[model samples]
Target: MTHRPRSSARRGDHSHGDVHLHGHGHAHGHDHPGHSHPTGVRGVLHGIFVPHSHDAADSIDDAMEAHSQGIRAVKVSLVLMLVTTVVQAVIVAFSGSVALLADTVHNLSDALTAVPLWIAFVLSRRVATRRYTYGFNRAEDLAGLFIVLMIALSAVVAAVEAIDRMVSPRPMENIGWVIAAGVVGFLGNEAVAVYRIRVGRRIGSAALVADGIHARTDGFTSLAVVAGGIGVLLGFPLADPIVGLLISAMIAVLLVGTVRSVGRRLMDGVEPELVDRAERALGEVIGIDSVDRVRMRWIGHRLHGDALVRTSATTLVDADRLASTAEETVRQRLPNLDEIAVRVVAVGS
Candidate 1:
């Protein structure tokens, strides 16, 4: 049998009475687990440099709130990045720093990437229609693919500019302005990176997280521009083109992780730990004999899945009770779960 609960709110408390069974169906809930930190120096460095994206402790329980939070993060970061790009562009005009120009171009593209994500967030808020049964949540994933393309485009542009500069060297003027602009770019991108990543992780948005990583890398690339400027000051004209080339390579390297993350989601790949957690939750149900199967996928920032369990309950009423309990238990275990189907099969059947 299936147990599905309906509610207007994202994470309202529901009792067994609230769940109505109509054959094999599903239920919905919005809650998440807490976060835990690892120990040792390695763990500390990892935490500081690469914070975990799916920390349950910071997750938003309300679906609407999560969307709102994602939109806010995108808007704020977009403005910050644009301002940084404009500042760097002004410096690039008179300074003739190829490295700064490359960084500025990438920053501009990064800022534009947020537009598609913002549209996706808005589309995701649409209710599921008969034709679009699953709603527009997949728009977020599509936006993620667009982000990857933008990153690739930026890398290509930076590499080409650097190569041309290397072949025909140009003396950079306003060395101090280029250095100051690099510092400004670094500060701006870093701030946006931190804000985007924090909100994205809390909202379970892979697209936002990817964008944040892009910005973080951009910040470092900006620092490379400063190094290039200093090298030019120290009588090394090749440093500017070289650093620009390095920035391009760095962008290409970082693109791999973002591609893997977004591609995995499109393929419906979920963390193995989440499956293990679901199995353990089902096994904990008092009357369940065994967990037959559990499958989960990401539908935007929320999770949806189904579980099959063999139960010892003989009567229909008993089996229904067991199924309800199992569903509830799974929801509690996976707070980010948007919907879950708990199917109970008789031990012999």
Candidate 2:
């Protein structure tokens, strides 16, 4: 939120592996290894395309990659949502259960949220003008907020439907079809899981990975509701309302968790893991006597940070080398870093 740089403001500023194979493995603390530092025109293309490199931790750059990754993810999720929603609606109609109907409605919103995010991704790619120095890095954040809002509203509706069903239990019909539909939805959820994990790792996006986790959990929750439907048809008719209550509780929990997550991102709460890794990386930078202190956080999927470093109190030329070397080293550590800065601190007070 603080503008740490300006036209003349020389104010200092501040992943992949197995992402190719499976749910882009957990973002390791290790920096990117074996990156081909491009030169001449290659460097420009590198800077333009790779998104991160030595000193590539600019805010706009981080946002750009996230915007691009968000688009790909939205498209994949959109198709999956559409496919699952149709199945859910058909099964819910045949089953005569509001719980299933509500689930169908919730699935439909996934597609709705993706559309706007896709648009934001497109808009975010534009070059920043004099008017906007950050070049729309916040676009993904806005789009992210929208997706979180949709999740909240869908949970609310799901909860309300569950309450209605609990009030007047409907004799569920076509139990087999409900179970079949739930199975289909669970499959779709796995598909989402696969896509999100793979792409998230490739791009190093925690948000997309989180989305995958949400989808995976939603599948089980839907399955639980389907089990209730089947049980109702098999004689324990009260099971329908009982599972409905459970689904309501699950929805409420998911809603709260999702909102809290998005709020944290928007409000700028740094992740502890990133902070720890940053501290270690800063310590490793060549010529850096000590890191002194580090402040790192997420901007979308991209990481941006500033470090107040205590050097050995070398000369001016040595100081610049120390600062740049430290910055570049930390930059290499985080493949998705958009901006990273190291401020020289004299050892003495």
Candidate 3:
């Protein structure tokens, strides 16, 4: 749902440093003392030589960090989806199944869509200049939309081919080969789909999650293909186009649903239920007088936002302590929170 954006104004701003961990998993050292000094050429030179893990390294432009594990999973997913698509396309061509060829073209589009999604993730982390406000927060959302579009386009092309087949039926010669290839593809994609779903959600990236679920959808479609191949093997001619049509329908429905969800987010839908929960949980803390207003948006699946509160403006010292405490408190309350910001405002009568 939606909750206010939260920023982790944690410890110190870690710009560039060597963060070495001890054997026991303790912060051994974080040395960036000279990195703060304005060294024009030397800074750039040191940066090039420094080896920072993607998770460890701050984006040169923005502080919005991405989950390295999740990104890697998508890259792998793209590779698998590509391979399977090719396999299906080849099968469809040799068997003279218009339905399979159409599905193949759809898969090709899915592979092409990955390029922009990866590019957006890298670009979204860029530091915001005077020109672009709110950073590139929606880049991930944009990528998610592209993925939905890719799936939809594939479904449409597949459906058209199925219709053509229905109008002019063609006999498939090698039903056995089609069935065998499809079974292998079916089991392979199903396994990858299941793994991607969990990994994507853990990292709170919508595109990754969507892609994972989409893989599952592909698994079902493959199953449908297998069923169609079995029908062919059994000497049922009409079953091929009929099953293909059913699979096409399922894909189109899923695609439409995906598009709607991403569209609402892009249009700025408020997820107030999450914000209310955040306020209630934070209010339980001793110093927090009342729940201010919490505003939230989807930074992937994680809720990111600011909680505006009306505190007793009397004691500045206690107030700062109270605000920081509340911010940390809220963070622990939710698993999907990336950054939480608390703004203290005095109630004016």
Candidate 2 TM-score versus the reference: 0.72
Predictions in order: lDDT:
0.75, 0.58, 0.56
Q: Give me the displacement of residue 119 in model 2, in angstroms.
A: 2.6
Can you tell me which runs of candidate 3 are displaced by over 4 Å? 1-65, 85-105, 270-273, 300-302
lDDT by residue (tens digit), candidate 3, 179-297? 75567567656666655655554544557656655665666666766787788778788787788787777676555545655775676653445556677767886755676567666
| Collision pairs in model 1 | 31-335, 32-335
| Weakest lDDT window of 10 consecutive positions for candidate 2 | 16-25
In terms of lDDT, the best-performing candidate is 1
Q: Supply candidate 1's per-residue lDDT for 72.
A: 91
Of candidates 3 and 1, the better by TM-score: 1
lDDT of 2 by residue, 276-318 (tens): 6677767886666776677655555555566666666446556
The better candidate by TM-score, 2 or 3, is 3
Model 1, which residues run further than 4 Å from truth?
A: 1-5, 11-49, 53-56, 89-106
Name the candidate, 1 or 3, with the larger lDDT value.
Answer: 1
